[model samples]
Target chain A: MAMVLYELCGIDEELRFSPYCWRVRYALAHKGLTAETRPWYFTDKEALAFSGSDKVPVLVDGDQAIADSYEILRYLDRSYPEAPLLGDGMAESRARFFKHYAERSLAPAMLRTIIMDLLNAIHPKDRDYFRETREKRFGRALEEFHSPAKGLAQLDAALEPLRGQLKESDFIDGAAPAAADYLVFGSFMWARVVSSADLVSNADPVYGWLERMLDLHDGLGRSAMRVTDVEGAYR
Target chain B: MAMVLYELCGIDEELRFSPYCWRVRYALAHKGLTAETRPWYFTDKEALAFSGSDKVPVLVDGDQAIADSYEILRYLDRSYPEAPLLGDGMAESRARFFKHYAERSLAPAMLRTIIMDLLNAIHPKDRDYFRETREKRFGRALEEFHSPAKGLAQLDAALEPLRGQLKESDFIDGAAPAAADYLVFGSFMWARVVSSADLVSNADPVYGWLERMLDLHDGLGRSAMRVTDVEGAYR
Candidate 1:
């Protein structure tokens, strides 16, 4: 009955808990799924191997080896359909439309920004740890992190669609949180963590909705998990 | 009750009856959904607007507007769960896993090659018509397609996990076609229509899969009406 979410517990300052991982964390909590946390530093190669990817926020659910936050979210929804991630009726379709946009378009921008600032933004103490670890897996110098311009462009393109949605509703779909909210939360959380809070801070309903989500996190004490040591474990 | 599928009938030299579109096409046929065809040219501006984006292979089921091929497929599965796009148990999971890979990874490379030769590859008679239409929607010169390097790299990166699947199984899963087959079929068909015949012919399992999917399309010809145009009637 226990699932383990293996993650990196903050190895650096800029190495915040990945929004990709955070989505799954929220899902497990939402579904009330009993999950054990496996925290690791960037040095922990063993955890990455068994998880099938070096990426954190991997869900080990019994015999199922699920990677990718979206996949993990899907697995959670199917396994526990009572609460329902997409929500009810027409909302399901609307939620999915925005969630797809968030994951496919928006999150990539936030992630790129985080990676681009690896040396300066990341905690100096853990910089070597992250560089050494990622080098082992990606076989590239962290220095060659791709330009953030393309990522930002895609993000802005994605947000163009949402501009109308926020104008109409308090949430991406309507009044309630759906998968889009959570998906965006993960990325926006990254923005929040890295001091790049302007991305959604004043953006209408998203701003208010994000505050509500932060409240939920505070209520649950889930946000207590720091971004430095066990950060990759949650990534 | 007959479910009318709104479709365009003409050849989309760029995207054509790609597996992505055909996935919907076949699903409509399989579910016994009565859909009308609305054949369109790739450059048709109004058609893209009606479809919610400048993309083809959109299916209009009454008022429900489903865009992404993945989202459309999922909608079909939910709306018509009796026959089931995904079969039972492990069969379904394995099928879904392949599809996730196809949509996320395989399609981009196919897009890269196809977009490269678009001008020369589209039907010569429709050349002017095609450019004008595409320009109206995408707002870019047809010749200045930027670069295929990024898309190619993404496609290759996405294919890494898929290469493992191909090595293990023939159909990207097994003997029968899964959703992955349908998802990937769209990209492959696009490649077949837009890439040099010689180039598409040389693309390995992608090339090989195209031949097999042709058989599936052939099957459609006998039982279902071949749609030729997308019209406002479906709206």
Candidate 2:
């Protein structure tokens, strides 16, 4: 029984753009596991109904299904017990902090910065569903929420902690990339795939770390299909 | 030789309030080690000159003098090895993230919120030096920076990451309060000891975690002499 991963994709199925999905993708690659990735769209709710989740990045292993990215990552480590995402109990706990930090701080700022770009990059079928749901959640029109200056400032401020951490170490989880690195790299991957705007500058230590992340697992992230050729903008 | 810790204090020598100092204080207690705390003020640069850094929380372990809270915490764990501050390398790396997060995000927001209170709480002898250096750093008059509403909003936003993590675990470092927990708790201790303003609300998970932190090491934080009696305000 092969493992299957449902990944959120753009107009081109090869362009997997969801940050949460990217986390699982990176985690699987880090653990040296490959899964049959099924491109999922925002409107493809019926397809995921079997997993009891209306979300992408849902992992279906032989007899078990994991909905959340964190859950899927934890499941992979526990089930495989080889090439662990979390090194130990204490490391696992600390990784949780980075995961939450990315979720609560980094991703939201990135979302604000590239919400429109993200909508444009997604399949045309997902456009209305994406805009409507996102606008409703934000309680503002899609256009109104797009403030590049404010979003960039917030994103820069949010990156400060990660920047400080990266300055001291090559990766968030120390010598090697771990669950913590993937948790944050997912956000950068989301921006890279959809937005033309450069989120981080070349001088920032985070940019160097991002380059290292892109080089991980045989250039997994660097080779990913992007909607725009804005990688040069960051450099 | 007995360990000696130089802590930053206010007009009343008992009012130990520096956030960095509090991290070392908590680290010492967490390691089940007691140090003879010597109160150091901003004007007393000569007092710390021997240590080669004009900073509080300088841990004098026998003949070795360790400056900086992070260094002190790492030294304690390395030298003592029993009741370790950092559990493992990966955990230590992650704890470094929390330490950096608190230093980069939490402390700056907190400093904004309580700058005036901090000025009022410091020793009269250190007032001129404190105001001069702090004003120079902020690039404004101390009075001009006092916007309670803005400061509170910034502080609340800064705490979102920690609040999210606390919702999932008992402490920042997971099941137990470790260096990560102390790193964040130190900032709260700074607010608790000096400012009468309640930085975090009771409804916040961070508030509960702060309460638990106050209860740790046989009420070490709870029993500390505070310049203001606003600990009840958080409750």
Candidate 3:
């Protein structure tokens, strides 16, 4: 049986915009493994029931089913050890820091900037569920909560640590892209695929790192489908 | 020819509070090495002139003089190669992420919280230099800019990433304290030695990690001299 990865997609299946799913997508590419991507929409809970997770980015390898982006990355690294997503035990722990940092800091900042854009990009069927859940989480309408100016400033501040680190090294993992790189790149992929707003300034070192990340894995991320021209939109 | 570290100190020679210097102190302990710490005051620029850098935490090992906390850690790991401060090249890179994260995010937040406290903690001779430089940096009187409530809130928000990661592991470097642990611990040590304000609540996982960090190296951090009682203040 071939390996399969369930990815969150829009009405256009090629519009795979979930940041968590993008993490797994990039992790697979990093590990030099190819898995058939199965498009799963936000409303498709039944499709993911076998994985015991309501979320997309579920990995089914042979008979084993794995869920959660972090868990899936760990599983891939542990199961395939050849081209490791995380380097070693010590490196893995450090990678977890960046993973958590991105999850807690960067993603939320990005979400606030592009919440409406994300809602529009998803499958029309998932619109009500997304809006209802997200509205409840923020305690306000999605449109009201998102301010591009405020979101962009918050994101720029959040990106400072990453910018500082990237200025000294080519990758977050240094010398090479790894799990930490993908963890952060996933957020940018979400922004690229869903939002037309310029999230990071071209002058920032983080912008340069993003270019390097997009160019990785045979231009896998570079070739990704975006809501607008990726070059013009991101720059 | 012995291992000697020049650490920043207050009027009370024993009251060493420079965050960068504390990083070296803990890092030396992590590597199972001992260095005789020399008290260096902020006004004592002539003392560090030989090292070609006007900085605290200048380490003199045999004939070699190294400056900068991050550089010193790398030097220690490379020179000793026993009980390494950084586990490997990969681990070192990952550690850099935390190092940079703490430096860029955590330290600035902490500095805001304790700037006035830090001024009060420095040597009487260094007071003028300290106030002049710091006030110039902020472009306002220290007292006007600082609000313990606002500072603590900013610090707590900045620490969210570290708090999230620490919930899963014993240390930032994972099972044991390493360069990254010392990198962040140094900032807390700055707050610990200078400020009476509770930067982290006892319920925070970060507070527990701080307890663990203090207990490392036979209570090296715990036994340090503070303007106020460290135990009563931190708790």
Candidate 4:
């Protein structure tokens, strides 16, 4: 195969929900490339060991399997060159500002809102691994810290900086959606796919942006399998 | 005058400490432009009336007067076109991400740590106006909300994303300081000038960035007057 991508999925392999994978997914579409996506569960770290990172979103292109979504995105920009992932002038460094903002702020805020929904959606074989790893990372049991309401509020407050920009521009990257937009879109995709938390109210600009994001790539995000379709997603 | 910037000052006209004004000051230095900075106090709202703004950091270049620090920064880029304040391509929009992060996150976190000190350093004549307006905005008297320790911790948390970036790059913009650097530096300058709270420990990456910022423009920040010298500054 010329290119292949490893993704994390749920009880049903179609329900891909990892935010990091979503970033790479959107980036590939942006670059106009196609890769056969292989759904992998959390229990299969050995499958990803070839890429030197026991994480999903590993892109195998030809002889090289690049691990890490950011690394893959950079590799795409380097190899493709036609469709750029980062910007010119000061965009690369400035974009890192948004990267960290989304990673440190948005992911934490959105994850709390949807962690339980995510746990119930992952494959049965991956449940304990997910729970154990996440609980250890959070230092508490999943049920003990699931505050959907508080999480939604933090997501709102955490989005103020992006909200200010979306008010004036269509995308975070001005008229066009680029890496920065995809960086943040991944989190909202995770929240939307795994839960019914109503993360952002309809009145919010973020909601409108989310809608636009779903509409991008010929409605790729809107077509993703949601918690409602999965058998064990708290139904 | 070719150019003049209206700035908020303290008991001494030289103790310029408004974070917004500091952005414009640093931006001016970045572009290698010279502007006569006029010290304005909080009591004199009428002095800025002609500019259609009740704020500091209003820039008047030749016949045109622009209010708001952001507008002034953009104005510099448009007019000067050399040593651009914002980046090219995706840089402009991406840079705004850092701009708002600094404005909404860093400013608030840093402010709570130094609010009381700020009151003590502002021109004694402007004290009542500053206290009344600020206390009303904050929904309490300054003393009621002065939790310096908690404030410092919050500031520390707020700097996490910046710290992550500074770990790899010398400047947030990479090698050269730009508008984004000034965006965050303004708040730090506010903390350092108006208070002795030691906002960041000496070992912090942010502290090193601050020291480097003070070294810029022939130590412009280092040369500014501080709360230590003023008799009424909580001595």
Candidate of highest DockQ: 3
Q: Model 3, A1-235: lDDT tens per residue?
A: 7789999887567878888988998899887898999999888899899999999789999999999999999899789988788777778888888778888888888888888878777778899999999899989999999887877766777887898889999998889888889998998998888877788889999999999998998888889887664333322
RMSD of 1: 9.4
User: Model 4 - which docking category?
Assistant: medium
Q: After superposition, how far is residue A199 of candidate 1 from its true place, in Å?
A: 6.3
In model 3, pairs of residues that clash are none
**Candidate 1 accuracy as TM-score:** 0.53
| Predicted candidate 1 versus true structure: per-residue lDDT over B1-235, tens digit per residue | 3344444333332234444676677666556665665555555657668667666566777777677666776788887776555543333323443344455445544454455455554444557876787667557875554356665655554444343334334554345444655655655554544443343324554445455566764555223322222221111
TM-score of chain B taken alone, every candidate: 0.60, 0.94, 0.94, 0.95
lDDT of 4 by residue, A5-53 (tens): 9999988889998888999999999988988999998889898888898
Q: What is the lDDT of residue B106 in candidate 1?
A: 58
User: How does each model score on lDDT?
Assistant: 0.55, 0.85, 0.85, 0.84
Model 2's A-chain: what TM-score?
A: 0.94
* Candidate 2 stretches greater than 4 Å from native: A229-235, B229-235
lDDT of 2 by residue, B142-215 (tens): 99877788778777777878878899999877788888888888988998888878888899998899899999
Native contacts recovered by model 2: 0.73
Off by over 4 Å in 1: A1-7, A11-21, A33-40, A43-112, A116-127, A137-140, A150-235, B1-23, B32-81, B85-128, B146-184, B197-235
A best-first ranking of the candidates according to their lDDT comes to 2, 3, 4, 1
Local accuracy of candidate 1 as per-residue lDDT tens digits, A15-89: 445667677767776677768877655556676787677677788888887887867877887778866665433
After TM-score superposition, the amount by which residue A103's alpha carbon in candidate 1 deviates from its true location, in angstroms, is 10
Q: After superposition, how far is residue A44 of candidate 3 from its true place, in Å?
A: 1.1
Clashing pairs in 2: none
